[model samples]
Target: MQIRPCADAFYASELEPWSEYISGQQGKDPGYDVLGWMIEETHKRGMEFHAWMNPYRISNSATAFATSGAANHPAKLHPEWTMKYDNLLIYRPALPEVKQHLLNVVDDLISKYDVDGIHFDDYFYPYPKGGVEIDDAADYAKYGAGYSNVGDFRRAQVDEVIEKIHNLLVAKKPGIVFSISPYGVWRNKASDPVAGSDSNSLQNYDDLYADVRKWCQNGWIDLVVPQLYASTSNVNMNFTKMCTWWNANSFEAKLAIGHALYRFGVPAEGAPYQTLDQLSDQFRISRSNKNTCGSFLFNATCFNENKINILSRLAQVYADKALIPVIGKESEAAPAKAGDIAVEGRTIAWKEQPGMRYAVYTVKPSSVEGKWDAKLTAVLAEPSWLAPGAGNYAVSVLNRDNAESELSQPVKVD
Candidate 1:
């Protein structure tokens, strides 16, 4: 649940001065080493960490420009390689070199750190504005043979990068999950009869060239968290209706609704800030969907403000207990064995070794057969006590962050 700022581009820009300055003041940058530290810290606090990375976007506003250095900046260094359509900045994804470079960045992160997953948000190709077009003519001319038009070329470009990234990630680290948060609107009903959403706004497929449907069908990503950040009555994009639409369309991968808790209680003209009731309604809808895994609130910082008492209510609902979001079934690895189990009166304890977490199970005697029934009692970051009068029990050690682990040999108690 970490809100990652753009740091890889900061390093690529050779703005070591700014990078060093920020790292020195903050004690660490959000690069591989820093992210690794954060993962360990979050795990210590009984939470899982996902490394969020934006794929094709280099920078957005002037603020990013100001923080960046001149000579080494991405736009400056690769002027011809950038697309400045509608004043939004985007790297030319059609270029093989650009795709390779982005892959290299991901490769470095995956190889170096033990991150749970690689995350990409809704900025696929810059949202098309007015009549302004994404300038990829030069790239298309250079690499666009066989494709009929620029649109097809652009779509193919995104597809190629996504497929390559997915394949490489699984190959390098089969246990790590790959996820994307594409723009909620896959397409309008007019465009595709089976489209999940009906927004008049820019579609991930039509405008951004992100062919999200194809990605889902191909199973390139482990999860698809669409950003359904609109109110219920907004005729163009009703949140609840869209959530159901997405769940219906998702192709076997985990589907988690990106809850817009940030918009809760914020004032706006016409579409005023949503009330707590509206937020609750969205949660209920998500829960009702059988295919839906769970929910992740956008931007963790939003919860800190306690706006409209949402955090208090959320904490009440999810106190003490933490949920380990289900990783891809294929990502599960062999379980690790529990070691050095010890007892002190009513409390039993054991070491949660590196790469393994603890799951305490209680055993009950079978009425009919010699076999005993084992039930998972708790999945925790640390060891804990068992109830008194336990007949037989075993502790299963799991990967802590993921549910992949082997059960420890059953211990007997009289």
Candidate 2:
């Protein structure tokens, strides 16, 4: 696995990325398993864990390189696989070795952990630097023999990596989701004319060489989250227009809106972010599209601060905890329902098949007689649950795709 080892167990192992991290404050804890611990904890709360990775980015800045990179680091071990731009290090995508290394990293992650998905962000090729160009002409000459333009050749290289990784995931762990969050605009009408967003913005296709649309078209990914960060009023890239464009372009993969929560209460972001109902407004539009599954916030910490009460508003919008949407034809079949539901002493337990999550619900009084109002309490990975207080409860088996089965026989506490 290309993931940096932080556990104390790796201190004596050959795979330790560097001795510095293991020896420093953040790393080399007595017996801390950072990544594994995170996955375990997340699943315990009935949440799916997706390991987010940036494929090409090696270093954020010169300071990051010096502090993080060691003699054992890939940048130091294989300098030929790296490109330095703006005091940053990026892996060369054209190299076959580089692609294999990325695949190896993914294989290592999914094999060793119970992660639900593998996630890739917008970065493919490095973002363009003004008046500066990526110097891959020589490699293009060797690899792009038949192609006239280097840009087309560069895109083809990226596409091949994405497809290969998708294939690997399907072969190794078919249950694991493959997801990508790319820049909102794929291309502008001015650029493509036939099939493109109406907004004028930096495009993933023309700029970053990330063809997220094609990935969805080919069913190469399970989910597509477009970072529609601009305000609704902005003429350059209106939020609604960008969102609609993405929903329209949504092919086989599920669509999700990426709201810029980080901009909330920031004066420079203009009035939209400052407005209290901005996020809800965007979410309303998201629900308008049947293909839109849900929405993601830019910075999760934004909810912690509750700046402008965005978190409180979200609590209202998402009153009930909903299961993640199931996608693809294969995911359509629902698993067998949970059975033998019982509340023994303090625990509520059930019997279900393997690789299933429990959707625990609280049964409340209904307006009509002989009926009950059930609210989803939590999606639990474990077979048993402990309720907050004595109450009526029900459990349902949620398959990996969250294709929920029929409710188990309801149980009431005395």
Candidate 3:
């Protein structure tokens, strides 16, 4: 599960430190941190927590929000660093201050929370509106060093941000994955010599100024989840065709398909997410490819609402709980073997290994040795794990990259 901590002004958040710019000062805090609660809850369910954001966007509409202190907002403080386009206030990527502010927000997240990954979707430059000009002439003139054209310069700014963030993640926390889910089509075949996809729609490079292909080629991110929100049958943005393209192109990052679960049973002009089966088919198609790591649903609320029986269809696909796919540099290390396993009452403990996490598994006492259908009880940072019940328990060492070592001998407890 992922929480949009630093989203547009609509969400009342405590994701960032509560000073003057957060919801806390405005009396919007619900007596708890939303991101903290989400992280704990998601971990309890044995799922990874990804902190997500739509960078550059401060607001989605024209209505001026009443912040606790408008002067405290970076948008208000540095008005020149932002642009008003499509009725939204967006931070200009070219500005050094704007890029630094975003980097600081990410730094705050990593320092404060224990998120498995950081996510950014395609919200770089606003979806274009005809005749709506973004006046970044001063920024372009000052900062456009290597690029001749403004378009290329804008793309470079976004690229720099991605590279900087990747560097920060590697330096501060190497295990934490950095991912971007850019718009599905990176570039059409007509646009670039290396572009392979045939879909002729809003390209990430041309329209949004997001050079996704460059990021992948340069190893700037750990995962690239292209928002393949189209139906497999849609001619413009075919899901199957795009998945094939992404898998072939994923250089250093793992490819995870972002399925548009929210669109299930929704109407459209030429293509509709007609049924739950459409999403199921997308899942199956993603799994069929060797490069495909996993998929992420658009929003978690859909499962809660059980929109158009999607939860049930998902249940069929996810019959068993699975570990998050290890990626990036972390996946290369195999953790050392677990040692000195012991159990007393309802507690299980093992000798600690350097830079390793412990995965505790439990099976029935009477279960056959070879037929040991062990279920993962807990993955703890510490060597000790609380025994779930009266079952035989085994422990293994999981390394920084999530690689698990061979299981130690099982200890039976009454």
Candidate 4:
């Protein structure tokens, strides 16, 4: 259940707000603060917690109506604000009330969770359906006052919501990253001669009504990860070529690739994906593109099925640790370097610097005597750490924006 009901309540009961005070009262209720505990557990394990949301999706299937949860769902309550495009139920994007409702939802989300980032994938206007013309002409006539065409008006509606959301993120959590992974192709050359991708494919612009390229150019989002779910040799939509294309267009935002890991070993996915090297090749392409900071694997659960030996290739590629690429306001002030560092056995402690995360590096022969390689060992939210094994350790400070300080004096361990 959500803490606060948004526009339509989305069929949720009002729960307690997430806060340190609520979290500190853990023993009172058995189900108290699950979200808070998840954040704590994730941070404790040196991983970032990002909240992913499909902003407009209400119901996945028509059968969802069978459940009592469906009865109170906003889509059911305010059916006027919804569209049944195929069996999928979605909020009408052109409505002002829907935009305000979505803003309220996002406001409630960021206000409650201790998430490191907010992630949204290509879920704007539903991918255009065949023979199904969007019947939003009346909505457009009402709300599309300044725009010329319905397409342009549709895109503008999406743009306004995104701009408002970006402003909200900036105001509420300046350091929090807001990212969108839209369809890989903004437009095919056939669609937009000059700015379109060379490949022929469905676009985020004309079809989906999501001007993802415009978002990147406008710098409204922090990161623009295109779902480049293709192989290196895929001539139509080559992975390498797409990476380069996105980099050139990403303006001030960082770029990342969205890999289709679910198709890696699937036979029906075609020749390119049949070869296990597909993912490795994609990573190689992403790394070669200097603007790419990281990547996201689709259906994140795909990695768990290692019977296909998915980890081996990536293990070699990711043998060393790297600090998170700096994001958020690039001009924010950096935190003070961790000083008065001490080592007791394999357990190291440093000066407590509140509101900052600590990065601990394992010192090898190359990193000793202050010539550090910065091979990150672990990032800790707490001031102390119990090293995995005996070795030299050094610590650094990281601001909310992930700005890192110089490594502290290395302490030796047997």
- The most accurate candidate by lDDT is 2
Worst 10 residues of 3 by lDDT: 8-17
lDDT of 1 by residue, 1-414 (tens): 423343333222222112333354212344554454677798775566677777766546534554543445455666665766654566788877678777877787667667778888887777767788677777889899999988888889889988998898878887777888887888888777665466666688888889887888888988999988887777777787788888887885789888777887677623534466676677778879988887878777676787778876676545544436566645555566776777655566776576566766776666867556677666667765564664556777666336645556666555
- Model 4 lDDT tens row, 1-414: 222221222212242122212233211333555667777798776677776667776655545532523344565567788776777667789888888877887777678777788777888887777877776888888888888889999899899999998999888877778888898888888888898878878888988899988887887989888999877877778788889899888987889889888886777888877666777778887999888999887875676975267777668768887878886565457888789888788788999987788998887666356375546788888899898888778899987778888888788766
Quote the lDDT for 93 in model 1. Answer: 85
Off by over 4 Å in 2: 1-31, 62-68, 328-334, 343-347, 363-373, 386-392
Q: How accurate is candidate 4 locally (lDDT)?
A: 0.75
Lowest summed lDDT window (length 10), candidate 1 = 9-18
Please write out the lDDT profile of model 2 over residues 323-344, one tens digit for every residue.
Answer: 8877543542568888887787
Q: Model 1: runs farther than 4 Å from truth?
A: 1-33, 62-67, 196-199, 269-274, 319-322, 329-332, 336-342, 351-354, 360-379, 382-395, 404-414
Note the residue pairs that clash in candidate 1.
Answer: 335-405, 335-406
On the 0 to 100 scale, the lDDT of residue 262 in model 2 is 91
My TM-score estimates for the predictions, one after another, are 0.82, 0.89, 0.83, 0.89
* Superior candidate under lDDT, 3 versus 4: 3
- The lDDT per prediction is 0.69, 0.77, 0.77, 0.75
Candidate 4: the clashing residue pairs are none
